[model samples]
Target: MFSKSSNETKIAVLEERLTSYEIMIKKIDEAIQIMGKTSQTISKMLAVHEEKLDNTHKNDELIIDRIKTMESKNTEEHHRVIERFEFIDSKINDRIEILDKKVDEVTKFRWLILGGVMIISFIFSQSSMVVDILTPDTDNVRIEKPR
Candidate 1:
């Protein structure tokens, strides 16, 4: 009877330990399920961030393209303006050359007229001296009364 009672006590302790192990396993399963849900939520948030980053990158590319296009247009306009300025400068230079030639002609004509006037004045003075010598001196003649 003593042996039978010891065996019954051992069996009861083992059954209690099995029930505790089962309870621990159930809690672990619940924790695993919560962790899986949290992991799924984090993955969704990361996907949304990636999409936003891609959109931003695309917008930056578009802005760069627009800037490049504007730069190209500005370069073409600059070249055109330079060409126009060169043409204007050439025209101005040609006009200045023409004006210089006209001034030279006018100066030459003035010198010629001055030389002609000097010669004419000298000839007129010489002719007046000759006429005075040829004319008889009237101051030297004395008046004679009739005898």
Candidate 2:
């Protein structure tokens, strides 16, 4: 009977140790589940951040392209304006040359008419001087008779 009692006490001790091991296993399973949920949440957040960064990069590229296009257009317009100004300057110079030629022609015509008038007046004056020199005094004989 003493041997039987000792054997039963050993069996009870084994059963309590088994129950403690089961409780520890349950706690470990709960910890593993929490860790899995946290990993999934972190992965989702990272994906969203990556998508936003990609969109921002694309928008920056688009803006840069548009700015380059506008600059090219502005440069083209500036070239056109410069060309127009050069054309106008050339036209003004041509008009000035034409005006100078016209002025020279007018001066020549004036000198020619003035020279013709001076020559005609000189010829008329010479004729009158010759007539006065050739005319004789006809009243001398009548005066002697009266005396």
Candidate 3:
């Protein structure tokens, strides 16, 4: 009977230990469930962040493309302005050349007129009849008493 009582006490202690192990297993299961929920939430947040990053990258690409387009337009406009300026400069130079030619022609005409005037004056001065007709004959004038 003493051996039987000792066996019963051992069984009771083992049963109590088994109950404690079951409780511990239940708490670990609850912890595992909480960790799973937290992991799911973190995954969702990461997905959202990745999506936002993708959108930002897309917007950046669009902005860069727009900037490149603007740069190209500016370059084209600059080239056009330069070409126009060069064209205007050539036109101005051509007009200046034409004016110079006109001035040379006018100067030659003036010189020709001056030469003609000088020749006419020399001819008139050397001619005796012209000189006599143009000037008064004071030396040849004789005063008569009977006039």
For 1-147, candidate 3 gives per-residue lDDT tens digits of 569889899999999999999999999999999999999999999999999999999999999999999999999999999999999999999999999999999999999999999999999999999999999777776878995
Model 1, 117-144: lDDT tens digits are 9987777667967668766777776889
Runs in model 3 with CA error above 4 Å? 103-147
Which stretch of 10 consecutive residues in model 1 shows the poorest summed lDDT? 128-137
TM-score of 3: 0.63
Candidate 2 lDDT for residue 129: 71
**Candidate number with the higher TM-score (2 or 3):** 3
TM-score, cand. 1: 0.62
Worst 10 residues of 3 by lDDT: 135-144
What TM-score would each prediction reach against the true structure? 0.62, 0.52, 0.63
lDDT of each: 0.90, 0.87, 0.97
List the RMSD of every prediction in angstroms. 6.4, 8.2, 5.0
Top candidate on lDDT is 3
